[model samples]
Every structure is written in C-alpha cells, then in structure tokens.
Target: MPPQTREVVVQKNVPATMRDGTTLFSNVYRPAEGGPYPVLLTRLPYGKDIPSYTTFLDPVRADGSGYIVVVQDVRGRFASGGEFEPFASEYEDGHDTVEWAARLPGADGRVGMFGLSYYGKTQWQAAVTKPPSLLSMVPGITWGNHLNGAQMRGGAYELGTIYSWAVTTIAPDILFRRYRDDPQQLGRKLPELVAAIDTLQAGGGYDVLPLTKLPDPDGLTPFVREGFERGVDDGWWEQLNIDGRYGNVSAVTLHIGGWYDIFLGETLRQYAAMKEVAERRGTAPPRLLVGPWTHGNFGSTLGELDFGIGSSGILLNYRGDLADYHLRFFDATLKGREEALADRPPVEVFVMGENRWRGYEEWPPPGAREEVWHLSGGGSLTREAPSGEPDAYDYDPKDPVPTLGGSILMPQIYRAGARDQSPNEERPDVLCYTSRPLEHDYTVLGPVWVRLFAASSAPDTDFVARLVDVHPDGRAIGIADGIIRASARESYPEPGVISPTAPSPIKPGEVYEYRIDLWATGNTFRAGHRIRLEVTSSSFPRWDRNLNTGESGARSSRTEVAHQRIFHDPDHPSSLTLTTVEG
Candidate 1:
C-alpha cells in the first residue's frame, strides 16, 4: 500500500485517437506530485461522469493510491465521436487507447484495466488484441461469448435482459443524440419516451406481440429488432464472440463473478480458458472470486436471503473491499510487487446456506464427485430408479409461468436472485419433485444439471428445471435454474458449451432426452432441509415464451396449449446431477 494518500489532479475530455480517425475522450485522474505511475484504464459506453460507473473503484481514490486512472467514453457514447455500434468498435479502439494512455505524462509504460459488466467486456476485447502496454485486468460480471449467455442462452433469446437494456438504458441516449440540436423535436419526443420507459419498468412493454417489433415507435433502437429477428444460428453473433479466441488474451486476469449474475457461466468459462492457456504456456495462473450476488447488487442481501455482511463487496470478510483487492492485484501484476498478492488465495467462493467464504487452489474444488438424484413417482426425488407413470401438466402459452427468481436481468419490478417458490409451486403448470429432509448436510459446490425425458403435444416447446432448497418451515428458495428449447437441444452438446446447429423440431408425442444446464452454485443444505426440483414449460419475459408452434417468438405470437409428459420409469429415468463435495 502507498505510505500516504497523494493529492489528485483531474483532466476532463482527454482525447485518444483511434486507427479509423475517430477520437474517444476520457477523464484522467493522477497524483499531483508523482514522477511516474502505472495507469489503470476503463472504457465504457456509460458516461464517465456517472458515479455509478466508478462505484467499483473511484478514480480519485485510485489516483491517491499512486495510480493514474483513465475513464474513457467509448466511441459513439457521451464525449466520443462516432456512430455507436455496440461491441463493434471496442477491439481496435481499446488497442489504440491503451498505447495512448501509456504515453501520457508522468506515467510508466504499463496499463491495467478494471470494471464490471460492459466495461469488463472492453478489457477482454483489449486483451485479445495483444496490446503491448496491457498487462492485467479485473473483469467482473462479464461474458466471454455474446451468443451463449449475453444475447441468447440455451437457444432462447434473452428477451428480458435485451429488451429492458435497450428500452431503459440504450434508447434514451440515442434519442438524446438524435434530437440534441433540435429542441422542438426533443421537447415533443422526450416525454413520450420517458412514459414508455416508465411503463416498461412497471412491467408493460414485455407483452407486446411480434417481439421483433417491440413498441419502438420512434425507431431509436434498430439493433433490438435486428437482434430479435436473427436466428440462433445466425453468423452475426460470431463476429463479437470470444469463444475460440481466448488463447489470444495474454493479460493476467482476476475474474470476479456472482452466482446469480446473468453472465456467470461465461465468467467461469473465461477463467477456465485462461487458466488452461497459462498452464500450457507456463505462465501465471488467473485468480477467481465468486459471491452470492446479482447483476447490479453485490450486497449481503439479495431477494430474500441474507448471506451476511461478509458477502458484501465493500468489506469482504474483514479483508479489504473490491477496490482494495484491485489495487493489490495491480500492484502485483503491473508494479512488479508480486509479494502483494502472496497472501491471497487463487479461488475464493462464498457458499450460501453455509453463508461463509471458502478458499481453494482452483474452482470445482478437487475431489468433488457428481451425484445423480432420480425423479420418482408421487413427486419424489430419490437415489434409486423405479418404475413409475409419467407425470403430466398442461402448458398454455397464453398464461405462461411468471418469471420467478433466479439468474435473470429485467426491470426493477422483476427481482433476481433466490426468492421463495412456494406460490409458484401451487400452480398446476409447474411439476414439483422434492426429496425428503436430509439426514446430514448436503454440500453442492459446482455445476448443476438436469436430464429430462419427456414428450410434448406440440411440435416444439421449452423445458425449465430449477433446483430449490426447501426449509423445514416450508419455504422453497430457488438455488439454480436452466432452460432448454426442444428444437435446439442438440446445440448444447455438453455443459458450458453452445454450438448452434440447424433447428430440429421433435415429433409431437415423441419422447426425447434433453439436458438442461442449470449453471453452477455453491450451497450446503443443512440437516432436515429438503431438496426440490421444479419442471416448467415457460418463464415468460425473462426468456421469450416458446409459443409451442415451432415458430420464433420474434416473428409469431400464435399461442398453443401443450400437454407435457415427464417420464421417470425404469427405461426413461430423468434425473438431476449435482457436483457434491464432502462437508
């Protein structure tokens, strides 16, 4: 740590020219009396002046800690000059900006990046370019592949996240930029847009028919329409995807993810990829830290449960805050003080239910074994496979299952994270298979998946699986969940991998096996607590409802009621698989 805090100087609208002659602007914060210092850079589409963007690590504080901080507005945003195309310009621009920042006055030729969400993505984009000045990064709550979890997941369009993001966040900026010079048009259109945003936040616009043509009357967000209309196998998503390009990233990384974050799967995938590359090249291994957090909420309490104050990013288990961790990491990687990170563990995860932090050398803790729990008759989950009749449920797209709690991003009305599922269980459309109270503590520390054997009356449909922790008091709290579109089930050949192929719709009333990737979770169900599994057809708005007509939800709004049958007989045993670690 720095012996004392230094006085800071601020420079606003510092310009950095990209290769295409487009100039991006950044706010520079530096120590007043420092001869030289390593630079920490973050480029984001969100305005650099916004306090929320810097909540992860304030530029002024970082400057006081003897680091020059640069917060840049990416091209086509705020102070940058260019047309805004999301995820299109970051690669080359990030490369140019890093070289420019390294040459700034009173700066050593070293640059490290840090940010959460889209800014985090900017870091990955920059690293993949192999910038000479880029050495380290902390990517929090970000995705590696745009198709897998960012834009779409399990072959279903991320309607809730994409729609809410465009309408509530992106549209306003485009509207402002369009009418900034014409006050008359701005005055006429601003109120209407505000009303639309308000209505959407209050859970209104999501139900609009022909999802491709969501109520964007002013045509502010054309990308939203294009995104919806594009098929899952479209070549468009491959341009920005970082799936097979991880080996190109040479920067030492410290990945930060949340169990309930929208991009949790990709975060883990990035870390695993980097770790593998490091091992192959005999380089330093990347570190990881996961907490029981939602997308924007890093607090102790999420939807209903409180994991304890130690879970907060502000003060993690009496260790310093997230900023402190970043400072130490930069000090080690950029400033050549490797000893600064000697005390920190490579992997630190917050296990819920146990409500505590645990450290290990790696993820998926060594010695963990996969355990299978079979679905049995009379709504029971057991270890033994038994003969039983298939359970049936009627799924009507007209009254699809409401988006309950789990890993979801939407407007404020729809909360994410673990919430009580008792009310949803009462609905006939949801099939519940619960295990009896555990005799001992059951600890699950890694990936969670469900293999379903079922048939539907419709040509195509969706299957949703949710793992719940049932308290002795009858509270069913969601842990992890996943969904698989029947037509694209083959696209996901294994966990954490999505290879979109031509859609193959199943024959009506034909039983097929589907694998639902529930992602991963770290939790310990205490003795006397029961485990539950929920099977449903739809999670509306969160994911666009599968119309059961073998048609894209983006183009068609035709509704169909499908009779679903779940098999658990000796020949067709559906089961839930969990990665279990000894307590």
Candidate 2:
C-alpha cells in the first residue's frame, strides 16, 4: 500500500421522505475537496458506525474512500424519525435517497450502491426504483429472492440464523433502547438483554422480541409481518424479485458471491435472469464474478480450511480487483467511458480448488455439457446408463434421514462440498445417487436440477436433492441443494398442499414429475473428486419436518415422523440434470 491522494471527508444530514409525511435521516460522507464526485451510498437500519473489517466507516472516513458515502439510520433506528417497519418503507425511501444524494454539492451526480446483508437487500429494492441518478451496484452476498429463499428455503425455516439475524441485525434500535453510534454497546447490552429476558419471563408485559409464526416458513421476518398478516405470497415478496424486469436494468452490476454463502443461489439467479432477459431482448447483460469466499468472503478463504497455502496459497486479489472493477465500471456505465472497458467479459468466474480466473462469452460457456448419473443398486452413484430394475426404499418421515449439507445455506453452515449423506443410508428414509470422481479438472456451472418421476405414499410430501463432491479421503462436501413441497407440485410460484390424513387421494399408484431447482455454482472438482447426489425427505432444524399421514402440523406442536420411499425403475426414470462445463 503506497501513498495516494486523499479526499477531504465531511458529514451532513440528508432527509428522505417516505410515502407518508415521515422523514428518515441519514449521515452523509462527502468529499470536502469540492464540486461533484461519484456517490456510493448505503441506507442501513444498522447504526451508521458499526465497525466493519478493520475500522468501521464514519461519514468522513467512509466518504473518503474516493467517493461520497452516505449511511442512514432507517426510519426509527438512530437519529431518524418515524415508526420502523422492516423492508416496508425502504423501496420508497430508497428512491428518495438516491434522488437526494445525487443533488448534493460535491456529488458527481451518479450513484453506485454496495454493502453486505441488509445493506445488500437495499440494493435489490433500490435498483428496481430506477432513479435517474442511480448508476451501478455491487450487491455482495445478499438475497436476490426474498421471503422463501433469504430467511426460508424450500418450505423450511431457519431457526438459529434468522432469529439471530433479527435480534442482532434487523431488530429496530428502539426495541432495545440502544443507539447506533455505540459499536460495542450492543454486545455490552447482551447482559442487560439477558436480564430483560428474565424480567419478561417473570411476567413483564413488554416482550422485546416479537416474532410470529406464519403458515409458510418464508414469512418469519419482522419486516415481513405485513405479508404474514395477509398470510400469503402477496406483492411484498414479489417486489424483491427482479425476474420479470431484468430487461429494464440500464446500470452495470458486478455480483460478488461464494460457494458457502446462503444467498449464493439467489446471487447466481439474479445474474442468470438478467442475462436471460438481455439475451431474449438481444442486449448486453450485467457482469458477474464468483469468488472463492464465504458469506462474508470479501477478503478471506472459502471456509475455515484455507484454500490459499504458502506463496501459491494466496487467494485472488479480491479487494484490489473489487476496487479496480468499481472504478472501471463507474467510468464505463456512469461516465460513458465505453472504450475503457470494452475488453471486459460478460462473466468472469473464479474456479475454486483450481483457484484461477476464466472468461466466458456467456454463462455456462457455449458448449458446456451435462452429465447424467443414474442411481444404482446398493449405494452406488454411476454414470453408466440404467436399463434395469427399480431400486426402492421406504422414507419414514418420523424416522427421516438427516440433511447432511449443501449449498442452500445460512451464515452458520459455511463449508463447500463438506457433507456426506452416507450415514443417512443406514436409515431407510434417505436415497443416495452418486457418480465417480473426475479423472481431471472439470467445472459444473449453472443450475444442478433434479427431475424425479416417482410417487409419494403420502398425499403431500417434499423432496430434497443435494449435490456433493466426495474427496478421496472420504470427505463428502456439499456443492448445491434444492427441494420442493409435493402438494405444490403443479404450480411454479404458488404453494401446493398434500393431505397427511389416512388414505389420501394423490397416492401410491400415481406418478409425478418433480423438478427440484438446485441453484447454481462455479467449482472445479479435480480428478478423483467424486460427485454424489443425496436425496431425502427431510432436513430437520434446517427444514420443518414433513409429518407423514399428511396431517396438519402446528409450528409449536409435536413432530410426527414420515414413512418415505424412492422408486427408480424402467417405468420411472428418476434422474439428475447437471449443467457441466468441460474443463
């Protein structure tokens, strides 16, 4: 790090008016050096100075990072005014914030947004507003799909992570009577919080953490209470998804994500959707970069195991590349510096394990192939085409097999391809389908979907599929995973139901085709790295268990195990569809 020109930092109070007359206050980071600079703003509910990395950014220091930085206390969090509702007011305030920041004296009149977690979600909503001054964004490891995917995945709710996220991350400051400027004050208050918990348990009417259970696991966030009150996938969830409007994006996007990141799937999904729309409309798409990092892998390893060891062990120059890309992208997209970045590819993926960068004309590469591995007899995952008898096993929901590991994640589950479903084989509830390790380096890009043509004994059931990379040392690391609730089989976006009562109508003799979207990943499983696919009915704790007999199970009520089975015969060609890149 050498000496460089430094910008003067100054702070200001910027006002963002909500749809109603309420005003949200923000602390702006502007260059005291004067007239107009590019603006990189993050309007977060977290207090303006929650020290991140080495030193957290205050208005002056934050805006000093070569641009005007603005951090706001969303609605009721800090110095801001108005009742705090989760993501409810952000979309509107976000639009107002962008318009407000661009007009600031030293602002370059172009806005670029970037941040982590909630900071990430802000980009999702803000981009949709399409403010004239808003230019580009680099949404790091954030959820592209809200409700079901962010907090809930495949009808399964995350208890530890989500609750912790709410308490530590999303809880409005007013709830704890805490202030944002106190970095360690929140942690210090934990003791008092414990005491508060004790007081509430001892008959205090003021219950601090108020989270209600929704019929669907996706509806658990405090911000999403508006949706839970309505009890459906109303406009709230859809507002976060840019699926249909990908074609409208005029700004350059640099998506940063990791294999162990819970939001990795959505990150890839947004990129792919954006490209899909661009292709359909015959326009250029957003740029993507898949790094070998974790949920917070901005400047670290893939997991606890350091991928970079020794001189050769150095991971990619992530921070350097990010700053470089941001500068160049701002020039290209916001400043009309077209020729400056004419050579940049639409997609640049970092292949883990191999640890190198590769450019692609399009995602998945032009001729990337697919590997079809059929499940075989006695716990073998073979690439050999199947032409024989069906292999069957009973899946008991009550004694359901445990979910080993996979890509669908929370910050807690931070390992890449680090899972083995073999242990579950001892139980009759799980089904394992695998393939031989590669003889050479190979890449699997895009979605790893599973199409199962089978029948469930229970009228309503859910199917889960996991993609794993088995090492020679017997370490089964999870790569990607996806699941679907059976009753909702026919519909794509809507919820479906299956009765658990005795002798349900859609049963035993019938066959159904269930498509489990396993999301996407960019990994290099070296030679001798075996590919394994684990299919099971339940991943407890990670997912709310499916009670057999298709009965209505209460959120707080007792659990009921299911009796499950898988049939892979000539009549039922149950198989996995992988988007493989020939390395």
RMSD (Cα, Å) for all candidates, in order, is: 1.4, 6.1
Q: After superposition, how far is residue 77 of candidate 1 from its true place, in Å?
A: 0.8
Stretches of model 1 off by over 4 angstroms after superposition: 1-5
For model 2, what is the alpha-carbon lDDT of residue 54?
A: 14
User: Candidate 1's residue-wise lDDT over 434-498, tens digit each?
Assistant: 99899999999999999899999999999999999999999999998888889988888678878
What candidate 2 gets wrong by more than 4 Å, as runs, is 5-7, 12-14, 53-66, 158-161, 172-174, 177-236, 276-284, 309-321, 338-344, 387-405, 408-428, 493-509, 549-558
TM-scores vs. true structure, each candidate: 0.98, 0.81
Instruction: Give the Cα lDDT of each candidate.
Output: 0.89, 0.60
Clash pairs (backbone) in predicted model 1: none
State, as a TM-score between 0 and 1, how close model 1 is to the true structure. Answer: 0.98
Alpha-carbon error at 448 in model 1, in Å?
A: 0.7
- The superposed Cα distance between candidate 2 and the true structure at residue 106, in angstroms, equals 1.4
